[model samples]
Target: MSWTDERIEQLRSMWEKGLTASQIADELGGVSRNAVIGKAHRLGLKSRPSPVKATDAKLAKPAKSPAAPKPAAAPPRAAVPAAPRPAAPPPKPEPRPAVAAPPTPDGAAPVPKPDAPRIVSIGPGGFIRQGPGDQQAPIPPAPPRRLVPAKPSPEIADKTSLLDLNDRICRWPMGHPGEPDFHFCGEAVNPGFPYCVEHCGRAYQAQLPRGTRRPPPPPPFGGPRVR
Candidate 1:
């Protein structure tokens, strides 16, 4: 609610009389305590500190106790001379031996041979070799491996290549179209036949009368089956 002139004067009077925000709000109808507080703050109105209640004053003042006796004065400390520190132990001697002086340049140092591949203790009789070029101990060269040509199987090796065939491919469609697992037969077509040997068996069942057309044998294991 808007703070009318009458409400503003009433709020100021109530605040000066030590009335809380809630009490002021109750006095002025249609106004909340927060609204009253906000208007009071905007009007630069100051609130008086709350006076101590009767019960609070009684609890705040603690009862007095009897005076305690004073403690006796302590005696003065005696001065004592500090004992002399023990002499530091002698320095420890080094454990390592002194290095020997190098010989004069007139006596040249022995040169070390270049490092190469060396064989050590291959078999019994202590056959240790210093290097491959060492003539005294010789190792024989390994024999070359002979490779045999692999024979092709009649079933797979005889089949026509998919690359050599025309775009016809196998006519046998696997599952119905619009199906989740729909797929078509992709094998090369047999000569004079729409379906491959595998699909041929699936496309046409065995004849009822004496069979004139003998269907080709089913494809090998793991080959596609007729859906």
Candidate 2:
């Protein structure tokens, strides 16, 4: 059976007893959690009220009673004999006649063979469930996407790289240590002769005179390396 009013009430009672949604769903074999939540919300189902103690119930009684009181002092009256009233007639009995069962429709009594693929609720649990044939709620379609390309920002492009951010495009110490003009014992800190702060060079060398070092060599690329 679907989650009818009675089933919702049962769920409310179970909730009052502290059973969780998953527990309820498990007991139901496979009722959807959303279904339970929706039913509870729509029906305003809530945990049962706490039981009131007998003493508390008595304490809540009104101080003033609504019943009228009888006179305290009363005068005596002469005794008189009275005749007894006649007995009331016996109550009329209800006529319960034999009733016959309605005739079954033709072919309905054959108990047509059960279909092979049909699913059945095997557990004896009290929870309600939806039919396997019931259509599931549809999944929503994906949202439309923007197709705009990312444009590079001129402000960022114009920002200069810090001195320490040398990406090492220079092959200044062209040949390795042992080659000619390798300058194994090299030292030109700013020009980063041997070890360009990366310590990639194994040897060090002293700097050349003012007009030395091949006029700071052209940037391998025809473009300028700095502004």
TM-score against native, each model? 0.25, 0.19
Candidate 2 at 145: error in angstroms?
A: 98
What alpha-carbon RMSD in Å does predicted model 2 have with respect to the real structure? 45.1
Per-residue CA lDDT of candidate 2, range 98-214, in tens? 445455677354433433555555445865465667559889998999988554345334332222234343223434545433322133343534344444444555678877667
Best-fitting candidate, scored by TM-score: 1
Compose the digit string of candidate 1's lDDT tens values, residues 1-227.
78789889998899988888888889898989789888988999995554547568889899999889889889988989999999999999877554455676789874554444365546567776555466664578889989875554453354333333455677566565555444456687777788788887787786666566667787789688779
Which residue pairs in model 2 clash with each other? 185-204, 185-205, 186-204, 186-205, 187-205
After superposition, the stretches of candidate 1 with alpha carbons farther than 4 Å from their true spots are 50-227
- C-alpha lDDT values of all predictions: 0.72, 0.57
Question: Clashes in candidate 1: how many?
Answer: 0
For candidate 2, what is the lDDT? 0.57
